[model samples]
Target: MIDSHCHITDKRYNADEVVSTFAEDGLEAVVTIGYDTATSIEAVRLAEKHERVFASVGIHPNEFTHEDSLDGILPLLSHPKVVAYGEIGLDYYWDEPERDVQKRKFIEQIELAISARLPIIIHSRDCDGDMLPILKSYAPRITDGLVMHCFSSSEELAKEYAKLGFYISFAGPITFKNAKKGDIIRAVPDDLILAETDCPYLTPMPHRGKLNYPAYVRYTIEKLAEERGVDFEYMERLTTVNAKKLFKKIVDFTGEKI
Candidate 1:
């Protein structure tokens, strides 16, 4: 199993301890994502020290400031442990309502991802109005790949993204009793479905209200398996395979690079 997206870089958790517990949680790789330059650097630091941890560096929509530069981020892509270019995209929920600014930064990062030949981890929210069209416009440039992190969109939108070749990642919210998107999970094809912890946030049910850790992903895996009515091992194999397919830099259990 693997956590396609997480933030072990967050001050809330001990990075070393989290990396050490990955195996016990049945996780093979954990992508410690960043939302800005500072967090991006922290993510790389974690990835550099832990073989099981990989990193994705980018500025989240809300983190985009005039001073931030894509040039600074481009260099990190060469790191062996750096797997992707994001957690970047539009977020209307925040005070950063400048759509043009968000779009420009997102496109710049998309270009960087293309140049680096790495997939992008998207962090879209409350911007469905323009998310699909913007993604559609840039679909040609996203050659490596992309994923909708902690996706909370409708099944219809999910299908649209699937058609655009974007992988759909589900997090803890899927396990919430109020979550009405089980149909969305069932709707996604096995090959494009992925799972994530999005830790220190979106912790899965039964463990909700507590700080999330990568190990808690098992509960999500269990929930997804139950939703699909498949065996736990089957769901695990499916998501792991899907994650490896997108984040090609991830290594296998034998230390063989994928």
Candidate 2:
């Protein structure tokens, strides 16, 4: 299976240890993401050292005030293992950089992804009011498609993203006891549904309080299959295919650099 989004570079887990355990954990490949310039570079380093690991380089919304500029991130995308441009989008929950700054950075990265011909992995939270419109405006240029990472928004907004041909990626939150978005899970088309662990953060049930890794992504997959009334293996294969479809730089299970 493919972990469409995660942060193996978070410093909580040994990057080498995590990357080495992908196969042992039943992961075919992993897209270790970046939220800032440092983590982005660490992601690229991990991708370089491990064949089954790939990187996504971008500045997070909260880091808008940081000195790191788009120019600093642009060079990293040239790395063969870099798959997408993001985990970049607006986040009003923390509201760290102000809405305007988040929107400006988000659009700047969107333009970069468009010009680079790379898919975008989005991280929208509570800012859907503005996020949806900005995404819609760039729909024409986002041929590589966009993925709503760790989606837990309303069905109405989910449909809006779907209309733009954007894929919805579900994480550990779906396995929570209070979760009520089963219909949303069922609503996503088979080809557009993706899975992730969002490791070290949204750890799935049975392991909810502990640290998460790529291996634990299976729990999220199992819950999704149960929710959607599909077989476990079928959900695994479907999400793997969907992940590759969106992050085209993933050449194969071997994670060869493109």
Candidate 3:
């Protein structure tokens, strides 16, 4: 299965066996996130060496102090397996510093992603303005490849993104009993839905407190299948097809031949 959004490059999961073993199951690939200049650089490095790992290049909202942060990001886009730009977006949850900087950094990364013509994995948390406007502002440049990674918004917002032609990517949060994430799974159109682990962070239940890895996505798929009332294999196929449609390059990297 495709883990549409994850952080394999995060030091927390960089172990050789941990990284290699996680994918031996149904796990196809993990998207390595570029959280800063240094990490963005490392992400591409991992993607280049590992066939099952792809890269997303961008600075996290909390990791930037200057526009120059894009310096390292721009060069990494040409890497063969670097497929997208982000984990970059507003996050009042991560840093309460100032809204302006977060907005600026978000916009800058959007501009860069647009220029590169790559999909952008997004993360927005508790910003004051309506989420759609923030997402819409970059619509002109995103080229229809924007993924709302680990989306935790309301069903209203999920429908809004579906209307905007953006993909709504869900994660382990959806498996939580009271998360209302179940509503999102039901509300999102099957064509517009995608799945992710966002590993090292939103690990699914039974392993909630442990470090997340790609193998655990099966648990999420099981939960999604139950929520949607479809068989597990059908849901897995739908997510796999949806992911390939969005990322596109996984077909090439893994020779998936789907």
Candidate number achieving the greatest TM-score relative to the actual structure: 2
TM-score of 3: 0.93
> What digit string (tens of lDDT, one per residue) describes model 1 on residues 1-258?
888899998989888987887777777888999888888989999888987888999888888754457666777888888889998899888766488888888888878788889999988888899888888988988878899999899999989999889999999998899887788998788889999989999989998998999888787888889999999999988888888889888853225332
lDDT of all predictions, in order shown?
Answer: 0.86, 0.87, 0.78
**RMSD in Å for candidate 1, one decimal?**
1.8
- Candidate whose lDDT is highest: 2
**Residue 54, candidate 1: alpha-carbon lDDT:** 89
Candidate 3 residue lDDT tens string, 99-197: 788887788778888788788888878763645787877676567388888888888888888887898888898787787667777888889788888
TM-score, one value per model: 0.95, 0.96, 0.93
Residues forming the 10-long window of minimal summed lDDT in candidate 2: 249-258
Clash number for candidate 2: 0
Q: Report the error of model 3 at residue 208, Å.
A: 1.3
Off by over 4 Å in 1: 252-258
In order of TM-score, best first, we have: 2, 1, 3
lDDT of 2 by residue, 7-70 (tens): 9888798888778777777787899999988889999998888888999999889887764487
